[model samples]
Target: MTCALIYRGNDILLCRDENDKLSFPVVDINNYDNSEIIYFETDGTQYAVLPEKTAETIAGGVWRGLRESWGELEPKTWNIAAKGAELAHFMQTNRFCGTCGTALVKASDISRRCPACKREFFPSLSPAIIVLVTRGEEALLVHAKSFRRPFYALVAGFVETGETIEECVAREIYEETSLRVTDIRYFGSQSWPFPSQLMLGFTARYASGRLRWADGELSDGGFFTRESHPLLPSLPSISRRLIDAWLNGEIGGK
Candidate 1:
């Protein structure tokens, strides 16, 4: 009811007191000036985005990225709180209407309305497709240029407008590794809120082509069997789930 998600920049405020248990600092919202704060609610819980100056004053756990805090927070709490954080980011960036430069006001729980232009903007979720491409006992894993570390992951790309998920899957696989794939079947989906993404998971069978990096987009890639798999992405990611499924023989009909 009275919970808040205080954030500073891209990091959230997580505190671990003398006992070393992780928690967010509880703030008295009324004490803060409303104009300087951004707040939102998710599933009946109130969350406030503390100003950087204000957040820095709180004592305890260091500010951490959402991914870094994941293991310390409950799964359901992290999911809901992360949504609140995303909403906070949206509101901060959308404070004014693009067309008329008018200040936008909250239209509903998840949208803002521009009174002058009569335009309503809602929170956006960018859809991305991540697929595990299998060739018999081996699966294709790739290292993208954007990854923070050198771990491998399934081929993934954002779904373009006017393209189906399956089409996006096929295009991304080929674009990244020059590989053709078939049996593009939905596996599962996840809400990855590192700035808002809906990850659509799939499993596909390699139809043709050899593993070749897509120049600037992919650094390296190859088809690897379970016994010879490389370092993987974080376990909390759907990419990891798809990879694990393939490794366990849950996919590819092995």
Candidate 2:
């Protein structure tokens, strides 16, 4: 499975790393020769420092000379260099060891190395569980307390230490909904680069217990049928796919 880097959404946003200071790591899909920086009356060459806005503009599906229809953008779908500015910030901030406060060096295997302590620090990504809980044909979703009213989403939480992925899923379900899951079927995963997270999406059958909201995470919880589906969060998201599988049958695309 290839993951996309640039988020054009049909509008493109170009990126540049002048002096390696900017964060957006956009590959020149056009593959223009960018050997040296030179200016001219007209663009001397097609090659140029990809401005951040170019990526965003193409992402929005608007072009200065040409145009495209309203369609989903087909991004490169792979970014070995990474995406989102915050990830760059994370790398920069965490370069120093918090324990000893020493400058770090980039390691060979995508991590920062400490010469003194011989410690290798990698880019940290949070593991979050998002489940599509079902009871019979109806699926469960929750309205998180902090969110605007009526915005329903799946039961999701960050995984903690000393917990298996399954354990985290079970714990999150019970803790948030006061409901237990009898079976959890692995559905799929997605890379959410808003910060950094590997989302593990699952489908769980509701075993027992009634609706109960724990703490401030979920303000409301309930079941919804396929026809009257709640205004759930966006699809193209792991959480949405899991529910979509349950509603439309896991095997067939709907």
Predicted structure 1: clash tally:
1
lDDT of each: 0.81, 0.59
What is candidate 1's local distance difference test score?
0.81
- Candidate 1 has which clashing residue pairs, if any? 15-61
User: TM-scores of all models?
Assistant: 0.91, 0.68
Which digits, one per residue and each the tens of the lDDT, describe model 1 over residues 67-113? 77777777886786588777877877788998999999888757899
Give candidate 1's TM-score: 0.91
**Tens digits of per-residue lDDT for model 2 on 1-254?**
11112322222232333653222333444443322211111122221233333344332222311012111222322122223332343454576876577887766424577878878886688899898888877888788877654668789889999999999999999898888997787788876654577888887888899888875688776988777877876535676677667677662222
Cα deviation at 24, candidate 1, in Å, is 2.1
Shift of residue 107 alpha carbon in model 2, Å:
3.1
